[model samples]
Target: MDPIVEVVALILGFVGWVMVGVALPNRYWKVSTVDGSVITTSTIYENLWMSCATDSTGVHNCREFPSLLALNGYIQASRALMIAAILLGTFGLVGSLVGIKCSKAGGENYILKGRIAGTAGVLFILQGLCTMVSVSWYAFNITQDFFDPFYPGTKYEIGEGLYIGWCSSVLAIAGGVCLACSCKAGTKEKYPLRYHDRGTAYSGAAPSRSAAASTYERNAYV
Candidate 1:
């Protein structure tokens, strides 16, 4: 297999993991408010409503007390996974480069290199799948729950940031797969194209009768 391709794929895999490890857990993501007032969890869940205070319209104001620690942990884990992804991506890129270099060298190990590249690509794909699943879950469920505790009452609209995360994961996966393909080392290519012994060409045939006889005589003498 092309060593360069393998290296590149490894690097990409690393990067992919890194990305996944970094940006996953945020429960109360803030968007613009209708009244132009910045609506954030910090603003809403600031004070204690000990007296069950009501507004001018006599509406009981229920302030939210979302758990930040749980969200923080999820986010940290997701971010760590993202970092791993980034590393994987970098590895894949390096592997691809190695594969290209090996191809140019016209070595007998081209098939091996290709096979290696293919393996790396498969790994990259697996990592990407994981990344997608984690990010999707966090964006839809964890983060949504953070914002609105009401079950079946909240619909999460994935923002641009989540989209970017997905895109990066996809890119890393693609690069890794490509590198693996480039470095795949096939069986035939792993072996020599032509079989020869001591500069004598060999055909897929038995030795000539005279040559066999000579070998026998030599053995007999020994």
Candidate 2:
């Protein structure tokens, strides 16, 4: 595998994983949108787990949702997805460290290492997908509520947490693609093109037995 590409992908995956962790506990998945209404005395914000409000006085108070069952459907699902994403990232990191070409964790069997790295890549991709779906679903609900004039509830706008999650998802997917490509490239070097189609090594040059013996001896020494 290309060591440079492997390292770059690992960096991307690590950053994305950290971003997801940051986003998960963030208090502002959505914020109350006042539409420039200065008269609006208090602004409210919420995330998957809790709600918070701040008055013009700059004092803010937050409270966890009273019950999980009472929370909105999208919020519950987002919570699950984000947790799953974190778990996937953890496994991917472990697998990546073990499988990376420069690492000694998996020994010198490069073909096996390549497979492990590819699996890690797949895990990272799944992590991105889960995070993407969670944030997008949450944002969709916020917009749907905000656009509904007849809806009696307080309207909210997308917040920093959702933006962070989106960015994390993008980084994760990009990293996974890079890692997968690197692992795929390793297979080419594992076998020479002359023998690739034949699924076996070239027997050697068509020549005298003595020449073949000499070639074999040189190969063995090398």
Candidate 2 on 1-222: residue-level lDDT in tens? Answer: 998999899889999999999999999899999885769889899999999999989999999999999887888999999999999999998888888899899999988999999899989999999999999999999999888888898889999999999999999988888898999998777667656655432334335666979999999999
> In candidate 2, which residue pairs get closer than 3 Å at backbone N, Cα or C atoms, i.e. clash?
none
TM-score of each: 0.47, 0.88
Task: List the global CA lDDT of all models.
Answer: 0.52, 0.91
Candidate No. with top lDDT: 2
Q: lDDT score of model 2?
A: 0.91
Q: Where does candidate 2 stray beyond 4 Å?
A: 193-222
| Model 1, span 1-222: residue lDDT tens | 445655565666666555554433322232222232354332211111111224435555544445545445555565556555556555544544444444453256655556545655765776686567656654665356546656553233444446656865776676567565654443445346544452354332346766889999999999
- lDDT for position 33 in model 2: 94
lDDT at residue 83 of model 2 (Cα atoms): 100
The superposed Cα distance between candidate 2 and the true structure at residue 106, in angstroms, equals: 1.6
